[model samples]
Target: MAIFHTSIKTFSRGKGQSAVAAAAYRGGLLLSDFVTGQQHDYRRRSGVVESFCLAPPDAPRWALDPRELWAVAEAAERRKDSTVAREFEVSLPHELSEEQRAHLAFVIADALVGRYGFAVQASIHAPGTPDGLNHHVHILATTRRIGSEGFGEKTRELDVGPSGKVQVQWIREMVAAATNAHLEAAGLTDTIDHRSLAEQARSAIERGDDLAAAALSREPTQHLGKHAAALAGKGVATDKASTNDQIAEENREHYDFLVRKAGLEGKPAPVPGHEPVKRGGRVFNAETAGLPGGLELRGVSGVRLQNLLLSSHGHTPEQAPISLAEKILDALRDVEEISRARADLAMEKIRDALRWAQRQLSSQGETSELRQWVTNAALQVRALKSLIISRARRLLNVKSATRLRHMAEQEWERFNADCPPGSTRYSRSEWTLRRGRRLSVLEKHTAELKAAQERASEGELNAIDADILAKAELLAGLPHPSVSALRIAEPKPVPPDDLGSTRSVPRGPTFH
Candidate 1:
């Protein structure tokens, strides 16, 4: 991808700048400043690949020539500290051919002319060195609108607090859009984004594309201008140059690590002192073995939690791919199928990592590091087991309760049809009492679910709470399901009724 960079600045006499000299240097021309009667000789200047001027349809003929245009621009501004011209400097992608680059420059120049009615003097500059990729264009635009009569009032809207910031942003976006369009037309996969790195990263993550997100998560380097760049080119380190080098290296390492971590690359990411462990003629992680994020004190379920988090973010469950091992286990009636394939691969990697840790404990001698690692690893493993068992139990109990509720409903239907309310089978008062007791138990489960809400993380809640919540609410909303009660807690026997009834409903159905 190409970098998105475009900037606007002004040549102000207050800042000791001359529009005539600036334009001459950019266009490789020799011209006199009509204002100061100053002759600026830049005809010997090299590296200019193209230079031209663009004017509005109603502009005077003199505005069409770079020399005449800037001369008039300087003459038009008379104050000692007057603002002379506005400049737009944009980098051109080295990936484009010369003709394409020139065409892009024309598009940008035409846009400026159409928007501001300014006479635009543009120069496309070659890189300082043939091997360099610093190809770019410099635009010197007049502050006033050009007409057949002459330069008119200054474009005050370009000031900072006014529409200036907005116009500059539009230019940035325009560069990005136009560059991408040309790249696509050229059949090049490279493109550009006008957003900041952080903004791009968030967008990628929101779309659930972590790989692209990882690439964008990197810190971008600072630009080194002419002097600092020259010094750095000669191998002298400057502060900015050093910082840029560090950022570039860090970005490279981070991207490489993420790619390797995500299993997009088979080669393990580099670590300062760690060496690859060669075993069975295969490369071993040496650190994680196969774990996601080497030595992380988390179980495979952590990956599951990540997927759950994604699902909780308004994404469909199918869009949040839980690990494949989970999928395979679910394919064994573990849970509903998820469509994501990335997590499935991550799951198998996690299993291998766990076994590796376990083997280390069995084979290696005791040490402080090993002890700490084992302690964390053991806790994660045990917690994972407990989590699995707890989920399985909850699912089984809810399923049983559902069936029992169904049975109870059927019994009520049958009793209502055949055995009337006043029939000898069961008294209306007794049925009402039993029904109230069942509702009380359902309320207990509902309370349990509600309480669990406070303790559960968003991940666990989405993964487990959804089913439990739905089932609990379903049972509570229905006429008390079972005669005995839900399996949540043991049922209390009914006390002696006023009619001298002593039979107790069996303690809630027991789950193995």
Candidate 2:
């Protein structure tokens, strides 16, 4: 395997306003000594140092004098138990670009927030060398750390104590995450893991070769497997650390039990909670699962509901590779676009079908004239519900262009479906029997999806907007005659005999 290299610099703020200075100093030191895949040290070339520090920039007004900052940084490094602080430069593989380097920094910073509940200040340094290969260095740090009382500046510098151990672990995680994210984004799966350098070193030591172990520890192992193989050539044996073994030792429970408990094995979704009430001959209930507290958190509208669901439950499920929220949001965005497109497609189909019907009738020598066929009123109501859902998805996804299209399609469908039959004048068209029943059902679904999408945005989490949109749209189209009639007149009742009892008898004059 070829080597893949990354440079991660860890810094600590001493006392006072020297935080940025300390950060820059550590950055320069790391840049100087980074392993650039070459045999000779790149820092030895005086030109490298001169060119690095002199790169174009109007230095910050708040920046401390370079001389004073360097003195402060050097003093901190000298305070460490490990006395030597040298900056070694390494040329990274040509595949990495400056943008990629910056992205890498962001990924590390973001992951740190997720794992450690802290955010970091980051910077990327572009490699300046003749190989035409790009090498970028990253600095992972915090502007300040939060304490119970208030925020405080970082006072401790980097060293090999408990804090050092913590920093090392942090570095390992950052490197691993950044590397994986960068490679994945770049569409490269077969790369190296730089985080396991320490583990590999420990393994090599256990194999009875002190020299090989020392070499592996000191030399940057860009590719863990390759590094191990090279060590093996010198009769140094090493084994990949077994995370499963570590977990088993930590927990006495059977592995299977642990897996299930951790939700490694598939777990069924819990049934959502709702209080059902019979209204207009249909079951109705207020959705409680995604709402703030089942009390309906105020100001959260339907437009944002899908995003809310994504925030609460999307990432927790193991079935999704990304966060469930992310998947849902992606799904929602896709579904909204799909639903809108679907409505348009549905229109096209309707137009084609209607046109064919008109032509066929004309060919049959009938003169009734199709006269602008419209969607059934019931279907129109369903379309409105679909439009609302699609619009909600669009808003949640931050895509607003499709909302109008969705609305128009819905209105068109409704106008075609619900207009009264045999109305000769346009004025009477407004009074046609509407499918109040089906519209009501669709309205409910549209409202729910909109609410979910809104919650997702508030939580700043991933949302399955598309999936919810599609499902809600489908529900809106369901036929419901009883509710449909609500808009036009009183709901029709069952015959008294069909009700299993005769409540009243009809009185009429006898023909005899």
Candidate 3:
């Protein structure tokens, strides 16, 4: 299981620096600070001090401006020793839909408020152009505790003291758990605990590694020595040097030292290659006699076989009956597994092909051929369902067998009319089973196609072309089109009751 790490840090901010005030100013909302004894009457706009001009008139009256909140949090980080509020941003792997992102923000907000008793500042922002993703949310939370610790007495608020190092850890753990639970419930299993690395810093905090000392002791940077700006600017020049001069000098000095230590300066120079050396076959000399496939091996493994052929049958593995039988059996089992896997893959491919065809026929308004194709596809799907039921029953898995049987029966019921049906002016025969069996099937197919067309019109997919059914899936998915206007008849106004009796009936060309 993947784990999410947590951390916390705190700092004694500079004199007169108020995180709450900054947040309020950035959000363009009036805020009351109990510490400073200030309150704003929003109804009369009487205490509109330092309002954010950029804020829209109808914006929510939340005091914590998301931008200011983020800024304050980021600034709170301790760069060297002092406190600086800062924020950590994480990029999710999957692009969530707008609805999903909204849900995430709400869940996080609720969790924070439930635990801390203070509402967190939450906001969603759109990425700049070039990013097609539709989801990005930022959560800013107050560091101070609004009420008593609920989780435990040793809660982050009470344990961390003033610096907040302790709080970061608990915050990370709780947030990660909440996020993981939410995503898991929604079937979004592919996610990352981005805070895990930063949480390691909490241990440093416990060890009394103050912010200043921690800042001085820089992490061992990996990948490259230069910073991003330097790297992007240009390459650096290097001094030229001989490749082996230093190594040769060291070797000569070592040789002299060894000669002196041995007390034999005139000793005959050690033969350069006289030392006995172990070759490839030394390890296997006589230790493996009766072991399987180990006695006087001849060419057997692929590499050995190739080497023997290269050397004209010089090396081979000695094989016994048991070893050969084991190898053969292993190969057979692998082949069988591969065959089964291939069959499953083929079935999946066929299913995908049929679905694609259905979509294509659905896009092309209504046509006799399209209707027939749809009917055939539906029957094929039903047949596959029947096969599934039969297999389940044979396997003796009653639960699965019953489930498949139920599904098969339901599908059969849907195939009401014999095999065909009739057509009508207002609604096609497809809408009713009273039509002939043949017409009924045709009508069903026609109805499905019409539905598909409607979906396409609502910006679901491109007009499904015949080519889509036959061609390899285009890797580039389709984009939804802009919403189009639908024509609606406007109702005319009726004459007022008070004016009804005042109108005189005029006769054409008759003098009154």
Candidate 1: deviation at residue 158, Å? 1.9
lDDT by residue (tens digit), candidate 3, 1-512:
22232223222356445544544533334555454465432333211111111111122223235434334343434433433222222222233433344444444444444444442554443321111222334443454323322111112452335736544544454455444444544565443443322343453366554332233223322222224323322323322112233544554555455446435645333211111122345333111111111111111111221222223323444432333223323333322322332343123433444444445445754344434443434333333333332332233223222332333333345444332334232246444533344344345434544443444442332323222222212211211111000111234445545756544545689688
**Clash totals, every prediction:** 2, 55, 45
Candidate 3 segments whose C-alpha is farther than 4 A from its true place: 1-94, 128-137, 147-167, 194-512
Per-residue lDDT of candidate 1, residues 214-311 (tens digit) = 67767778888888877874557899988987998997788777757767555444322112222233422212121121111122222222233233
Residue by residue across 1-512, what tens digits does model 2's lDDT show? 21345443443333222333433443433222121121222222211111112100122211123333233233334333322121212223335433344444444444443333322333344322212233444333332333332224442433447885665554454354345335544655434444354665575578654433443443221233436544543434455324333443443333334335436435421111111111233321112121111111111122222233333333331222333223223323333333443553233332333344434444653222222121242233244445554444445333211232233345446645645455553355343433343344346435544554564464433334454355444444533323333334555564767668966756798997
User: Residue pairs in steric clash, candidate 1?
Assistant: 323-343, 324-344
RMSD in order of candidates: 34.6, 28.9, 35.6
Sorting all predicted structures by lDDT, with the top scorer first, yields 1, 2, 3
Which numbered prediction scores highest in TM-score against the true structure?
Answer: 1
Best by lDDT: 1
- Following a full C-alpha superposition, what root-mean-square deviation does model 2 have from the true structure? 28.9
